[model samples]
Target: MAVAPLLVFMGAAFGLPAIAIATGAFTTSADAPGGVRWTLSNLTTSVHGAYLTALWGSVRLSALSALLATVLGVPLAQAVVTSGSRALRDAVMSASGVLANFGGVPLAFAFVATLGNAGVLTTRLHLAARGWSLYSFWGLVVVYLYFLLPLMVLTIAPALEGLRAGWREAARNNGATSWQFWRHVALPVLAPSLLGGYVLLFGSAFAAYATAAAMVGSSVPLLTSQIADALSGNVLVGQGNVALALSVDMVVVAGAVMAVYVPLQRRSARWLA
Candidate 1:
């Protein structure tokens, strides 16, 4: 009863829109004999041609960025957790929170200013001669890492801290070295959290539109960019419903990621607790 208002808000805010998208994905625009006929054509179309390419590109970018972030973040998180300085830990956590939220136009513009052709770093460091272009896929990956890496640190820090010292001591009692303890015990326990963190990062990268739009536009071919193009009739007129179908695909991918992330996070919480 106490949460009734929240439930109603959720229904209004999210449920109605989801219902609309699902309907739009399957229904044609009003016209013809019956007016707005139900069809699976949009969904089918969304998975073919340029749409498929966009979907794959988004997935590949997210996976690569998430992987790099997780690989680099774990050691950084472990270092902070083991460090004795409270101030440093607090500063890092605070900075991570700020950086993880730093995206969109300003971030894109910052990269362009520093990494773009004839830009600050490109000129000073002669990056252009080395074939570094801020408008490419790998450049976008590096830009994504600026934020995803921090997000990874924030996500895994609590799990790292939650690791009981008693477990380490017990492992040492059995003649386990540091590497052996990490391999046999720590890695197993931390695996769920690490995987969950990666999923979270992937979702963030996957849904990101503003930075990608501002930075690379359609050159890199992302689903989010495609959706925008479709919605705006940039590719062709009257593609709004198809855009909805593309959004439905994006929603499906995000839902699947959440399905995996939730269970992993719960398992990690149990182990950490």
Candidate 2:
């Protein structure tokens, strides 16, 4: 009886909305009045120029951010775990936690103040004299890394805490070098947490809106922005067509990430024990 209300809540709150959106995306108006008529046309139509470009950009940014996050995160996580005192580790961890949520419009504005044209760093370096541009794809990648790196640190830090020093000591006692120890022992144990963290990072990168919107200001489009544009004022004119299609695209991206994630998680569980 306790489970019944929970089931009903989940079904109505989550499942029902998902089904309604999925059905609405596929259905055309002709078949049943006030009912969605099923078709793949919406999805197909969303795969075009600006939409495609945004999709590609979002994916690329997400990949770069995830990679950067892993690189910066792992080291910081190790630092937090291996530190001497609980007080110091807690302080460092708390700082990273604050940064992990430091994205969206404020972050965008910060970057702009520092990295944009006529901005602090630009003038300091005289970058315009060097014929460099900071408003393109590379700029976006840098922005993503700022938000992503700290998140990676926070996510992997807990896993690092759970890992005991004995594993590495054992590997070294067996004459393993640092690289060999990490590859054979540490990585296997850390794989699940690292990969899970990357997924969260990637999803954040994928769904980012305010930062991208504020940073590039339409110079470079992103998937989330495109979706917003599609559904802006009137949801009906576009028939919510493009918006629906983009939602499906987002689902596909999430599904692809889960494909790798599920197996990685299983393998990590085995490695950790």
Candidate 3:
């Protein structure tokens, strides 16, 4: 009884929508004579040409953004965990919590204000003359890093905290230098957590929509934007089924990311245990 309401909410909010999308992806159009016929045409259409390009673009963007986040986040997380100042640590964690959830259209506008063609820094630095454009792929990368970095920090902070200080002491007592200690002890223990964090960031970037949509419109090929276009019939009429097919594909990719993440998370838990 305690969890019944939550179960009902999940069924309505997620279960029903997922079922609808899956069914619609395989169902023939209503105009067809038969009541409902299953077809693979929608999935077939979703895998070719522009759709294919969008999918690949999304994969590349997610991988790059996540990789950048991991590279920067690990050090930042370690710093926060090892800092002696409680106030500083609290401030950073609080900011991270807020920033991690700050995305969509507002984040896009914020970037525009800072890096757009007529933006303060852009104009001041003459970035346009230097051929820098905020609507480009690298520009998106910079914007994505804003949220991705914070998310990575929050995800890895707990793992960093789990690092027992005694291990470092033991390493030092054993004549291990700082570099040797990290390479031999720290890195190995943190490996699973780092990989898991990367996977989480990858999925977050993969499913993102509004920020990219607002920043570059459809000029940037991405799966989420393509789904929006298909559903809105912006490019071709009656592409809703195709959009559903793309959603299915996105779900599959997310599932695969988790499939890898779960194992790493379990392994990391063993170390902490």
Candidate 4:
């Protein structure tokens, strides 16, 4: 009873949309005899040819960006944890929380203004002559990292903070160098947290749409952009259902990631708590 409003909100927001998507994904359009017939054609089309290419492109980009973020973010989390300044830690955490939620066309526009071909930094730093292009694949990865790295810092910081100081002391007393300590004791204990953080970042990158769409247009061939194109009639008419099928595919992939992430997150929580 206490959570009725939350439940109602979820139903109206996610539940309704999910039902519509599922219905659209597996049925013929409204013009079908007796109003819509069951079919696998939409789902099948979603996984072939150009759609397949877009799906793979999204997977490659998300995986690469998330992996890079995890590698770099663990150190950032560790630094904040060990900084020994509560004010500094709080400031960084606050900033991270905001950045993690920042995306969409605004983020894309900001990057373009700062890193695009005619951007001020591009001209001043001669990045264009150096083979830099903000609308390219690697450029998108860099933009994604702007938010992903911060999210990684947030997700792993609590685990880092929970690290017992005595472990470091014990390692030191046993002559374990900093590198050896992390390679062995620290990393082994933090493995679940690290993996969970990586999965979280992967999902964020996977479902991202507006930023990719605005930044590179169809030049990148991401699944999200393809879905938008289908739904907006930018492609063949009646492809809206194909867009729905693509969304279903995205949901399945996200569901699989969450299936792995939830357990790792729970394990990390138990250890950290």
Which prediction has more favorable lDDT, 1 or 3?
Answer: 1
Model 1 alpha-carbon miss at residue 248, Å: 0.8
Error of model 3, residue 150, in angstroms: 0.5
Question: Using alpha carbons, what is the TM-score of model 2?
Answer: 0.85
All candidates' lDDT scores?
0.95, 0.80, 0.94, 0.94
**Candidate 4 residue lDDT tens string, 149-232:** 999999999999888889999999999999999898888889999999999999999999889989999999899989989988
In order of appearance, the predictions have TM-scores of 0.97, 0.85, 0.97, 0.96
Model 2 residue runs over 4 Å out of place are 1-13, 29-36, 233-239
**Number of the top lDDT candidate:** 1
Candidate order by decreasing lDDT:
1, 3, 4, 2
Per-candidate count of clashing residue pairs (backbone under 3 Å): 0, 2, 0, 0
Cand. 3 TM to true fold: 0.97
Judged by lDDT against the true structure, how good is candidate 2? 0.80
Better of 2 and 4 by TM-score: 4
Window of ten residues with lowest summed lDDT in model 2: 233-242
Clashing pairs in 4: none
Candidate 4 all-Cα RMSD: 1.3
